[model samples]
Target: MPQETTDEPGVTRPRITPLDIVRTLVLVVALATLGLWGFGSWTMPWNIVIGIGAPVVVLLVWALFLSPRPVLHVHPFLRALVELLIYVGVTLAWWSMGSAWAGIAFAVVAVTSGLLAGRRALT
Candidate 1:
């Protein structure tokens, strides 16, 4: 997706980069994992609640603080911190479901992508 950058007085849309694609993929994977974790790890009724709720919560948090245009404009460091926390939560969720290697691998990719994206955001 093209993101609007305020390089000039007018709104200029910038071409999406590879990092942007990866970031979007990471987010999709994270939401899917959270949904699966909720359903797979819980009982019937609670599973229904959490399976839907987990992804919704993550989406809200991301929209508020981590999106290209966030509702809450925080410091870049704070934004990164929130992003890291979400990744950590997903990693731990994977580990809890007996997928230690998957969690670690996701952590590696997610953190690397986040760092690169954060660096670009800072610049």
Candidate 2:
């Protein structure tokens, strides 16, 4: 079983798990992949716009709805939906950039990690 920790005098939180680490790595890779796709697939000015903008936008969305302490308080299911959408968008971006194998591999790992995380969250 996983362990728990006290973050404050009265607040108890679950300890970070292996799944949490995997999920965090997946998010970082997804953001990097988006930036790379933008930089590789566009011209000078447009590349600059997208390469910087894509990750920023994704990061903002994550902060708003998916961060450990999100800006918005939403249902866990809603949070999962948002997270899934980001993953799918990044996977599609990879495929659109002609990295079908990378996209497939990323999707497989992402979905698996997501499902495990979601299961933990739900329980």
Question: In terms of TM-score, which candidate is strongest?
Answer: 1
Local distance difference test, candidate 1: 0.94
Clashing pairs in 2: none
lDDT per residue as tens, model 2, 13-92? 67888888998999899999999988998999999999999999999999999887899989988988998899899999
Poorest 10 consecutive residues by lDDT, candidate 1: 5-14
Each model's lDDT: 0.94, 0.91
* Stretches > 4 Å off in candidate 1: 1-11
**Taking the tens digit of each residue's C-alpha lDDT, what string does model 1 give over 76-114?**
889999999999999999999999999999999999999
Query: By TM-score, how accurate is candidate 1?
Result: 0.89
Pairs that collide, model 1: none
TM-score of 2: 0.86
